[model samples]
Target: MTSNPPKNPLHSARLSFRAPESPSDDDFFSAMVSDIDAYMNSNITNATVPGSKQAKKYQEYLTEKTLLGVVICLRSTHVDGNESEKPTPIGAMHLCKSGDGMTHHRSTEIGIEILDGFQGKGYGSEALTWILEWAFRRLGLHRVQVRAFGWNVRAIELYKRLGFTEEGRWRDALWHDGQFWDDVQLSMLEDDWKQRAERNLDR
Candidate 1:
């Protein structure tokens, strides 16, 4: 069985977390389809169709998970107690504690896709840090892993900054843009995270 960690004080960052559920199918489909397109076009250098079969498959997975859960929308931090700024929800991160086969354990593989406009500016880092803390402290996960091509230096740095260590690297795993690029695998355990957290606390 999977367990969530007790809420930690470090997670008091002023941000809102919304479970994956849109008001209507049309909204979900439109938003997700665009997200999938952005992910494919930006991440996969050699991606074909603007939307691929894999995109559809992931969409189907989200739609069929009415009982398990829906995709979450991570909103940005709100400024003063004034008018509420509408969130763009440019990026998405998936979480699942119950799964069949290899992933059925106290671990989760995070796949993040930020929209074209929100590629940088620390949003990815904030969202990932929040999610990892929730996974380790709130969900009591043993470990969390993320994979990205070596070319994605920004993401690599973000993962490392969040206490993730390089666990593996698949040399020349993907051939794109007329050259082969290596895939880097990064991971962080609960203990490792705590150590990092403590060190940061002391600093």
Candidate 2:
């Protein structure tokens, strides 16, 4: 099982995060691939693969991206003398760095997609916080950015509540679901993530 941690979970309090353990891992396939509901509001305007060809599509995705992406999972319950049970996957997240060499050191964009069944249960928030910490401290990134559609007030509000600043809005940048919507850009600097309360952005 080749994975980021191999056997251990990533740094999340209520969930497990790790690289895909296998190409055929059923849990991963269901949560990240076949789960159309999870991607409903995500706006996959750049998707290159058809829904039915997910396995190959996923492998291509892995090969094409310059980033650290992880499968988010529910921590497995430990049983007597059986602590090796695998966690159940629930979603995916990533920190995609800039492809431009000049900008690689200081910034990355984050994306979080939770399963429809798993949304709004604090799991996303927990995962986001841990990733932000990793971005600033572990990756030494100067800024971590994220984007949401203007209509996705829930996601934007969550990002703000967690310390991201509204950076800009691209007017009618994305045409989705029959209407053009603004792409709302937001970001958090290293200092902002570290001194959120001091900046009054953590409210």
lDDT of all the models against the reference?
0.62, 0.73
- Least lDDT summed over 10 consecutive residues: which range in candidate 1? 65-74
User: TM-score per candidate, in order?
Assistant: 0.72, 0.80
TM-score of 1: 0.72
Q: What TM-score does candidate 2 get on C-alpha atoms?
A: 0.80
User: What digit string (tens of lDDT, one per residue) describes model 2 on residues 1-203?
Assistant: 76554433364655777775555554455446556645655645534333646645563554357467777777755554233566767777788857766665688899888877888898888899878877887788998899998768889999998989999999998776678889999999988887874565646
The C-alpha stretches of model 2 lying farther than 4 A from their native spots are: 1-9, 46-50, 62-64, 78-84, 197-203
Model 2 lDDT, full chain set: 0.73
Give per-residue lDDT, candidate 2, residue 1: 75
Candidate 1 lDDT tens digits, 1-203: 97975754432343344444434434543555556445543355445443445555555555564222233343445475332564344555655445666454688767666665666667667677777777888778888888888767777888898778999899998776577778899998989988887898999
Off by over 4 Å in 1: 1-15, 22-46, 52-56, 63-85, 96-105
